[model samples]
Structure formats: structure tokens, C-alpha cells
Target: MSADNEIVELKSHNSNFILNIFTDDYKKAIDNIKQKFERGSLLKDISVINSINAKDLNIIDIQRIKDFLKTELNIDYKEKKIIKKNTKEPKKEILKENIPKVVKADILEDDNYKTKIIKSPLRSGASVSYDGNILVIGDVNAGAELIASGSIIVLGVLRGFANAGAKGDKKAMVIANKIVATQLRIAEFIAIPPKDDKKSYSGVQMALIKEKGIEIQQVN
Candidate 1:
């Protein structure tokens, strides 16, 4: 299973430990915690963890885990509240009301900006190039190539080569339902998947430029 799907993952930040719980399987979680303590992997210097981040667990389950930790190992930790990202749609009327009279102006669509949508799957040896955004409705088989000046969005699996921001737009992003791509590029940066990687993913994923380089993350 992927790390994201693991029952628990322990990480340290600024010398403080944090327990990240991914599932509500109380027994499995407790077993994993026991193993960690038995192996002296996480607890060596401190008896307290900073907090527990359990987004997928309920209050009862969380309390049960906390009780188990306190009673079994005498360890104590805080429960960190999950803060969800805001995703509300912006209201146009509110925007207009807040705009200054001097700054009022018409918003015109960019005539030069375009998006290309393909309805068919890209087979091996197939090559597609678009000056603007590219959207593929089907899977991109290995050996296929896609180049776009803007962003690239694949509705199905992407196992080929994809180059976005071909004109050097560092802000461009690539998204796919399932990305097992051999290679991905955005602007001057490139990312190649590890050889013989057997990890499986369950959700949509995205690749974008980050401070360190191209970063792939599950799209929530």
C-alpha cells in the first residue's frame, strides 16, 4: 500500500513528533503503534507527541486511540483539529460591489488563448502538440507524446511523456486521473518516475513546479 494509505505515519517537525493517522482501523493502528514502540523507532527521548492528525477518523475512534496510548504506553499527545481548505465559488456581485469606481472595467476573454480537446486515446507512437491548453479524453499509452504551451489535462491514465509550458510558463500544471508517466516536464524542469516503481494510486493526481522541482501530489 502507498504511504498515504498506511494506517499510521510518524513524522517529526522542528524536533517535535506528529502522528498522522490515515484510517479508522483501530486495531491495526494500535498494532502499528505497539510495533513502533517495541522497536524504539519513534519514542526515545520524549514521552509526548505534538499532536495527532486523524482526518478520516471519528471522535470516538480518536478517543479510543488516545486512551490506548495513555493506558498501554503512558504516552500523551494532543489532538490537532483538521482545517479544511476553502473551496467556495466567488460571487461576481460581491466582486463588483467591492471594486472601486475608478478601477471598474470590462473583462474581455483573451482571443489568442485557446484550448485543444482530444476525444480519442493516444496510442503508442502518437504525438500531439498544441499551442494552448491540451485536454485528452482518453488514456495516453506508453511511447505516446504530448506537448502543450499551456497546461495538460488527461482524463484517463497517462503513461507516456507529457511536456507542459513548452514556451516556458512556469505556472503551468499537468493533471491526470492516474499518472504513471515515464516522464513529465513543466517549463525548464523535468521529472522522471523511478524505475521499476510498483506503487499504486487510487485518486486523481497532479504535477506542478515547486521550489525544489517538479512535485507530484494526490489531488484532493
Candidate 2:
């Protein structure tokens, strides 16, 4: 935990973590996370991802560095945001109970399941249930909620409520990179994300099970 610190990701079922403060010297990343909160190594949920430039450091200097990491590490301050990455994206993996190489090479490739990784940004009350497969690297904001019995990915921007398979497994699916979620489900089918007036929407969206039911496309 040096070379200017970098524990890129961790979400032990919401015990949360995602350091990575690649030096732009916000006081040398808050004194290298205050020497890893004096060697107790900042546990009990952490979040210090920074790319700076919030009008040159704002939000009361990021709440005074989350109040000095909760008074020098008694740890617990569940939220903070300031992200910006793209060195060609791709490189942020953390599915502890393993199973994600694009969900085992494309949707559980003959099912072996086991994936649950939610790093942050599931704002508005936050909720996440799982039985298998559920990966949200961030943003499910607008009233956050996600239940999964299998299949439910959101690499970002999926404005709320998601209920993939949820114990039914009707070929569960609900991918997203921006699906202004009004509501969504998979097993006992339910969805809504198409009220187009050509609002200039683009690719990378999906919602499975289709036989005149839940169907949303564009995965290219």
C-alpha cells in the first residue's frame, strides 16, 4: 500500500473499498491515506478514488477528506464520488466469488455462476440482493435497488430498480451502460426503457427474455 497507494477495488459484499488515488498530490493523496489510517489499513468500508478537479478540489475539500477518514480511521463514511478514467477503459475487475471475464465469456457460458461485485455508486438508499451473478461497477443511482438470482450487470448508469431472474431464471438478463431505468425485471418479465422521440440514445443496452415481452436491444 505504497508507491502512493492503490487498492483499486474491493466490495466484500458491501464492506466496500476502492482507493486508487493516483497522485495529483491532494497533499500526496491525503498523506498516503494518513499512513493507511495508521496501519489499521482503513477497513470497515472505504472510498478514496480521486481524479481531482472538482473546481480544483471542492465539496468542502471532499468533506475535509471525509473528515480525516472518519477521525483518523474509526472508518465509516459510505459515500463520495469523483471519477474519471479512460486510458482505453477496461481494467477494473473485482468479482470476489469469481466469474466475470464478461460473465464467463458471455453470460455464464453454460452456467457455473458466482459473481457479485458492486464497487460504488448505487446511491439513493442503496440495496443489493444476490444469489448469483450481479456486477455493478457503479451508478444505479435514482433510488437504487437490485435483486438477482442470476444475471444483472450495470457497468454504469442504470437509474434504479433491477430484478434479474430473482429466483425464477427465465434466461435472466439486464445489462446496461445507460438504460435510464424506469423499472426492470427479468424472470417474471417486466421492463420499460423505450419511450423514444429520438432522444439520441446509442448502443450498449440489453434486457432479455423476448417473446413479445421484456426486450431491449443494442449490444453493439
Candidate 3:
């Protein structure tokens, strides 16, 4: 579902799809819907919020799944709005450490400042967003998405979709310990991992958007 408060999960039966009802307020919601949308077409495709669990089914089609929301749930599919990004270097930070006698300060600054650390696995249909850099010490699972205004670093496998410098900054970079994502985006460019490399990508890899295109490289 495109609505902010609702989510749609699909069930698979060969090529056909099954509908299930799942809602916080089932009676009120279904009554309201019946009085409004279904009043026109009693047999029209309708939303059935499953009282059962959503985790037990296998979803196959994203479009058909979305259609149920529009016809049955009154959910509007909003178009993604793209915004321009700034490339100016961000402010600085100095860390001071005093161990016994000496004083130490480490400078940290970049186009976008701050770092967010994620410690859990990103499941399908879930998304994470940050204003600065991101460091995920967990897996970015398929269908999950990560969006950052600055750089992004995934210390574990990245098999989902990710967007770095989502505000339009091309200077942003993404570093990961493993690469398995179907596609990665930097600014307006997109890159897909090579099909020839099914050997389970390991080590360090980095990607950036250039005049040529999205380029992946070893982080060495």
C-alpha cells in the first residue's frame, strides 16, 4: 500500500493471488470502505485485511499487490519526487582523548557530516534513512532499501537496493564488505552487480557515480 499508515503483503497460489485482510480497526475500516468504495461495485476487487499473520505467505507480483490498495483501500500511489542535492563540504568535528598525560584530537569532516550505525538485519519491505553517513554492521536483505544523504558503509552483505547521496550529490560513496545487490544508485546513476560474479562477493567494495556511470571498485 502507498499509504503511510498501511502495508500490503501478498500470497501466492501458482499464478493466481489470494487476498487477505489485515487492519488495526477491522470493523470500522471495512464498514467505511463498504459504505464508500464497494457501494458502487459490490463485486469489485476489494481490500481484505487479514486477521491472520502476514509472514506466512509468498508474495509474487508487486504491481497486482499495489493495485489492491488503489481499488480497495483508497490508497493513492504518490509519484517519487526528486530533489537537488548540494555538494559543499560539511562542518568539522574534533575528538579529544586524554589517556594519563597527552591530549589527542581527531578531525572529522566531509560533504555531509554525522554517521549512523545499524546493528540489525534489514528485512524485505523495510527501509532505513539517514541524513549523514551510514554504517550498517548487518545484512541489507533483498527488497530492503537504505537511503543516505552522505556516504554509506555496509560492513556485511548488501543484497538489497541502496541510494547514497539521495539528495543529488554525486560526491557521495558507498562501501560494503560484500556486494550482492541487484542495483545501487548514486545521485542519478545506477549500477548492477555483475552476473558473472555469483561467487558470493566478499572483501571491500566501493561505488561512485561519475560522468561515465556507476563504477564499482575494490576499497583498497
Candidate 4:
């Protein structure tokens, strides 16, 4: 940006754009990245079509970088690549049948659902969102959150807030071995207990949203 010649209309026609910045500008870009990350600006809309120069583009998470732009400056940009298919040859149609269908809310029950296992502690500021049952083999600590489109299970502990059925899945539940949550939510339901309800030994507790209210029970 120090260059007296400011950005003008690009010279390449029908070609993808390159920031075309100086290599030293990387430091400034990194500073900007750190600032946005600390702010927890969630970039909702942005995508990565492809990569150009690997050396230049591989330095950062391009998707999150786009998100940072949108979050910090309200800018959404997609760097697209033009792919020209061979028109002369016969078009080979490949069916995509192996991809699993993404599950959403309104399951009516958390039973018969497959639980996703995460073998790590939920660190502060770290968030996880899933479409099926979420089972963490670690603690859900304070200032951390676990949100599931389906049910959630903690193999170790659940101390922070856990939100089940973030996308209107009213039947989603929260199951934890050690319960010490700051708050809890299921579907449109929410609960904030008066004290840190620490469970003795290993116990199984389930949470549900009944009539838009969070309810808990010792199931096992």
C-alpha cells in the first residue's frame, strides 16, 4: 500500500486476480490475521475455489481469511479459477453416490444415533459443532462450548456450556459422565443452574428440551 501507484483495474482479462503485494507485506498481513482471530470474528460467507501459486497461497487458512475479511471489514470475496472442460470429447458423467447425507435437526430422539468421539480437552475459546452425537473423551472446560446439531456426550467431563440441537433439533440431548456445566441448552431451551453441580464418581446424565425448557435427568 506504500506504493504511490494504487490498485487500479487489473491488467489480465478473463484471468484470476492476485493481490500482487510485496513479500514484506506478509508481516502486515499476519498482524491483521492475529487481530481478527483474537476478536473471534466468524466469517459466515466465503469459499475457496482453488489455489493459485502454492507458495503464496499456502501460508494461511484461506477460508478463515475470507471470514476475517467479512467479519472485520464486511467484505466477501471469492478467488475463483476458470476451468475449461474438453468439449470435443464425450462428457463422462460420474455419479456421486459415496458421500454421506448430512443430518440436521428434528430427530425426535437421540437414541439409535451414531456418536462422534473427540479425544481431546475442549479448550477455552475452542468450539465444536456437529450434526450427530458428540462424544468428547476430555473435559469441556469453562469459557468453552459444545454445540451439536444432534446429541452431545462427554466421556470425561462437561463443565462449560453445552448446546444440543443448535438447528431446531428438539429431540437432541446432552449426556456427560461428569457434570459441572455453567449453563446448558437444548433446541430452544436454556438452563443456568444456581451452583456448579458437580457429580460424584462417574455418572450418566441426559439433557432434553421439553416445552422449550431444558430438563436434566440421571439416566444411567
Question: Could you tell me every candidate's TM-score relative to the true structure?
Answer: 0.48, 0.24, 0.49, 0.47
Name the regions of candidate 4 deviating beyond 4 angstroms: 1-114, 197-202
Cα shift from native, residue 70, model 3 (Å): 24
- Where in model 3 is the C-alpha error above 4 Å? 1-111, 196-202
Residue pairs in candidate 4 whose N, alpha carbon or C atoms collide under 3 angstroms: none
Stretches > 4 Å off in candidate 1 = 1-112, 195-202
Please give the range of 10 consecutive residues that has the lowest summed lDDT in model 2: 49-58
The superposed Cα distance between candidate 2 and the true structure at residue 117, in angstroms, equals 16
Candidate 4 shows a clash count of 0
Task: Give the TM-score (vs. native) of candidate 1.
Answer: 0.48
**Candidate with maximal TM-score:** 3
Please estimate how well model 2 matches the true structure, expressed as its whole-model Cα lDDT: 0.61
Estimate the overall C-alpha local distance difference test score of candidate 4: 0.54
- The Cα error of candidate 1 at residue 157, in Å, is 0.7
lDDT of 2 by residue, 66-110 (tens): 455556665434333334554453434334643335444666442
lDDT per residue, candidate 1, 136-193, as tens digits?
8788999998888677878788999998766556667788777888898876577995
Best candidate (score: lDDT): 1
Q: lDDT scores for all predictions?
A: 0.69, 0.61, 0.57, 0.54
Of the two candidates 1 and 3, the one with more favorable TM-score, higher being better, is 3
Residue range 71-108, candidate 4, lDDT tens digits: 66554343443446644543222223221111222222
